[model samples]
Target: MNTRSQTPIPNVDDTTGEYATFARVQVDRWRDGQRETVEDVVAEEVPIALEYNGISHAVMMATPADLEDFALGFSLTEGIVATPGELYECEIVPGCEGVQVQMRIATERFVALKEKRRNLTGRTGCGLCGAETLEQAVRHPKAVAQGGAQFTVQQLHAALEQMQARQQLQQATGATHAAAWMDAQGGIVLVREDVGRHNALDKLIGALAEAETDFSQGAAIITSRASYEMVQKAATVGIGFIAAISAPTALAIRLAEETDVTLVGFVRRQGHVVYARPHRLR
Candidate 1:
């Protein structure tokens, strides 16, 4: 089991913990009525199994990078663990079939996880997998703290601009989504990329938590549409502001309003749309 982080490379085997998140392959190209062969890079989605206290909990298809962060983040956002302290140790084990993140969590949290009795096979786009009832599927977290942090339109736009250059994985494979943590001054603090947008956010959250980041003083910037699950994750972690480069779902807006999260979407250089809690933005 390797917990150290590694950079993703092209077209590598998965027998080791440092598995490649992208692969380079040959592709047929047609341009101007001419056909040729070219090498292309594509994002690799692996079945990442999350095991808590040696019990298999859920499996998600995600890029293999910053997986330790992913494990902690998933645990936190999925309510498996109430706080980062509840998660003790995370081991990244790569195998021929896929990767397994074996986590050792607090006994109390593990007991609660077992009580929920959820065995999810999560896909890249599906967040609520194997949920039996509506209540289990649409979970609402506690409301975020009021008047924690605020950002202006200029800061949001500047963060959006800075985030583009920091997305190394997306620039390589063009098949991954990115989630970045931006401070109030519009500086991109950290970025995480994954095949699944939710996974990316989870990874970012995990990294931020590991660094003891102040969730109230920064915003989450995502390069995908804002979904209800995204808002739920942010609010659960006490993130007061979120900005998306694309549109946000109606359910996401409603949850943001209910959770006192400032949700902004369609973020561009010109302007952006504030769907909920406009007071958070200047």
Candidate 2:
């Protein structure tokens, strides 16, 4: 509905194109008589405003990549709409302030959305926002249906290692988080990264939806702590297991137990602790 010009932000350089012109430099610390330069890379944060059916919903500041997935994932995880098809259309309107993601949803869903609107006053460190109450913060989804999602110890270890290797942004900026989905055989099939941990998971979910990947037969691996919200998001996708590199909160553990999603925490180089639903892991 709105139109504006958009410019690309430079992040990767491989000796091709304009980004290649900037040469790497080395810097040294000098007290008083020398000058030096440090090798540096630049990243930009763009504001993304989500509007549902001509009504303003929420805005987020994130790296301007995989926007379509971001929009769809946000809508589904935030409960704006049940499925991606509920979003009739989505367009990116660029402005000096930020990129506005204008989304059109079903009329009935829009009416439901307006009632849940809250004044999100500040930028969120994570992609989660606009919750007016504490109960909303801990919104729970039905537990995943246990089918035949069983993983061996060897497969679990391999999935964790694969997830680590797929963190390209973390390797570059050292400031991003990643969430990955691994299939039953333990191969990391899809990985998403973002400045926000929740956003990374959302993007992963969105990508899965777009690619039509089957989540019922795999697990979700994250590079951060397993919080209650994280557990909820994983459960929303019907993931049978969630393995994290950090500890799980009490709420997260409780939700995992209730949802029947296997929760594994403290996943490190060689060991991990299964907090809940250990039956999924062999």
Candidate 3:
């Protein structure tokens, strides 16, 4: 099978042949002296190559868990396939170098995906690709239905806090991002984390779809900056509102306005800035 490779979690100490190490530190104790310590750990990245009808499309570095979600979400967001059913098969093949995700889409979708392909390349952090122009790079998704979503400022504030508290991988590595679903009652119902911000949001969408959650009745809370693609993804999945812990880019704001997505940025413990579609939030 065609495969893609990514960096695996490296071993910290050769003594145990494991991904851990020991450290010694000098401490000025009143009654005791310095001490030595040991810790066990591993680092893993999600390396996935998207193949459509057996042709390689793109490879991304992400957290190697929930790969089925990653494949489906990426396919949907990138316009590779119109619906999840277009993707017929997916599998993860582990290798000595990294994990290779193989996906097979319908023949019709594969042809369309091939025609839309560009010479674009991806780095560890890049999300948008295959765009021939700046405008294409920021293609706006259709507006989401407002659909009776109403939440007080207090509820939004509480939801942001709840999303932050649920980011377990971010707390552990300080290197991951999270996307969460919050009900009008300020309760977070679902959360997904990943090394890549886009992947985190994709995982959340996949999880919501898998659970048959009612996304139109709630909002999405993200623990990262709001980007144009992020806004597009939320809107694509029929989310009416999105709250982020950081600022939204100008393009992101424009897209949110066109897409009828309520965009809130600079969200803190007490307040937030509404950039677009404020009507959704009461």
Candidate 4:
């Protein structure tokens, strides 16, 4: 029942936006050549400011839901904290422009975070937009210690089908992306949706870390394209494989190769493309 953390499950009251997933707006709908006024549902994108130890780190545009997960995931994948234990507690504070996810972390991590970046913020689609240089932008993750996670082509297809059932946010607004964790046989376990693909993956990684799932037993499935940063995030979190509904970029493929991650893309009901470590997915 505690959604804030995996370690102690902080006793703080939940300040996350329970009803802020989507909003309704009036729009014109065309039916049989006739346009009529109707209500349209859109995904809610809010500014999520991440502050570590009261110091502003990054203000990202994300769905105002499961922000605690977002904070934990972002911290791990972004290299702010080496482990989830470093994060003590997360305080969600809603403001005029957006929600500020205040994370109480170890002083060492906070000091390192401050030394890494003085100020950083990014929108949904901007990967490493705030990084100062190419080296900082493409910080590669250490290769996965355990790779060669095997799955069948049929399992990949089934995983894609299961991912659809968990995409509630995308079904509602048709504008959000989802990241799901599925067992090796292709059973959906945990899913997180967000306006940003990276954030969605971060949330999923946070959940995976909480559950401490065996990396060899499952793979990550994403609703968006597999970018270089996506592979980096997966490798950073020690995910052995990734299946995406779209294609993988050149940089993503290269990163997957270097990180020893099995990357699969264009995952539909019938087929998929293996961009990296094809031997892992039959």
Best by TM-score: 1
Per-prediction TM-score to the true structure, in the order listed: 0.93, 0.85, 0.82, 0.91
Model 2 C-alpha lDDT per residue in residues 104-172, reported as the tens digit of each score: 999998888877766442264553465778777678888788774789878888888888888776776
Candidate 1 deviant stretches above 4 angstroms: 1-17
Question: Which ranges of candidate 4 are over 4 A from the true structure?
Answer: 1-17
* Model 2 misplaced stretches (Cα beyond 4 Å): 1-36, 121-124
1-282 per-residue lDDT for model 1 (tens digits): 999646432235668736677788999999999999999998898889999999999989999889999998999898889889999999987776688899999998899888888899999978888887798888898898878767777788888988999998899988999999998677998999999999999999999998988898899999999999999999989999999999999999999999999999999988888899988899
Q: What is the lDDT of residue 95 in candidate 4?
A: 65
Worst 10 residues of 2 by lDDT: 16-25
Deviation in angstroms for 254 in model 3?
0.7
Name the lDDT of candidate 2: 0.77
Give all candidate RMSDs, comma-separated: 5.0, 5.2, 6.1, 6.9
Query: For model 3, how big is the CA root-mean-square deviation?
Result: 6.1
- Arrange candidates by TM-score, descending: 1, 4, 2, 3
Model 2 root-mean-square deviation:
5.2
The per-model lDDT (C-alpha) reads: 0.89, 0.77, 0.75, 0.83
Is 2 or 3 the stronger prediction by TM-score?
Answer: 2
TM-score of 1: 0.93
Ranking by lDDT: 1, 4, 2, 3
